[model samples]
Target: MMESMVIFHRCRSLAATDAFYIQQLGLTLWHTQPGCHIYDSGYGYLGFVEAADFELPAYSCISFNCTDCAEVDRLYEKFKGMKGITAPRRHPQFAVYSFFIQDPDGYTVEFQKIVKEGEQ
Candidate 1:
């Protein structure tokens, strides 16, 4: 079957960006190059590239589903010690826990936890 995924950002710091997603967010690396890092997003992939001269428009951001909202909050807090961090908050649209943060290049990231199969 044909496949596709999103390259969320053409980042400025390829190494730093890769480390953030790999080491911090814990996304498994599918592949890596001098200019890019491909990550497995379960159903697809996410890539980060070194784009020193790329002009990016205002993007809405990508949401990653998590099983535990508290775990996501914990990670958010742990990552706060690093440079450029944001606090996690609840999503306004749905009844789920979510947190918003920026990557190395100021790309918005939403980590959300959806309700389980049987619970409300």
Candidate 2:
């Protein structure tokens, strides 16, 4: 059987990234390696490694799946003040109620709830 998963990305400053994911996003710190910090996202894990010279990808997205539309709405209200945040709305094509926000590292983080089961 397959276990859980962890997605890793490169970050310029560990301290700043830590604050954003931990304080702002309210993710629990799952583990800490020498230059990497992993956060538990309830569904899976997200890890960031300190790399001063790393060039961030032009397009990168990290998405979180909410249990329902209400959860998605709550997250939108919580992070509405953040830079690059979008208003939550239903995407009929994708069958989701979702929104996007930019993390401190300029990563596009999406919060979404699947409106149609088995679509995603």
Candidate 3:
């Protein structure tokens, strides 16, 4: 049985990635440094690392469920200039409002708030 959870992203710049997830997405920071940062995203722990340790995968996106979709967009807009976050919009498949942004390491991070259930 899986007792705990962890998601790690191999990034090119840990500091930038940390800031985007922490500052932009408003995720609580568990640990922070130049090459690594651990964040508590209310659902699980997310770790961002910058090292020649893991092979970079094809462009992947991670969806985070939030309480408020509006706030998600607000924070994303705030960090858009500082962190170079791209504008995010609604996700058609999930019937949820989704904000898409690129992390410092160029990983697509989607902040999604499901508005309704059983959306196609």
Q: Scored by CA lDDT, what does every candidate get?
A: 0.74, 0.90, 0.71
For model 1, which pairs clash?
A: none
Better of 2 and 3 by TM-score: 2
Tens-place lDDT per residue, model 1, 1-120, is: 857765655878877777778888888889877788889877678887788796555765767887787877877777676554556766567777777777767777777778655643
lDDT of 3 by residue, 27-115 (tens): 88887776788899777899877876555678687877767777677757665664435566676565778666666665677766787
Best by lDDT: 2
In terms of TM-score, how similar is model 1 to the real structure?
A: 0.74
Off by over 4 Å in 1: 3-8, 81-86, 116-120
Number of backbone collisions per candidate, in order?
0, 0, 1
Could you tell me every candidate's TM-score relative to the true structure?
A: 0.74, 0.90, 0.69
- Residue 84 lDDT (model 2): 93
Give the TM-score comparing model 3 with the true structure, all chains together: 0.69
Count steric clashes of candidate 3.
Answer: 1
Error of 3 at 29 (Å): 3.1
lDDT of 2 by residue, 14-100 (tens): 899988999999999999989999999888999999997988798899989998888998989988889999999888587878999
Error of 2 at 73 (Å): 1.1
Global lDDT for candidate 3? 0.71
Model 2 regions more than 4 Å off: 117-120
Q: After superposition, how far is residue 8 of candidate 1 from its true place, in Å?
A: 4.9
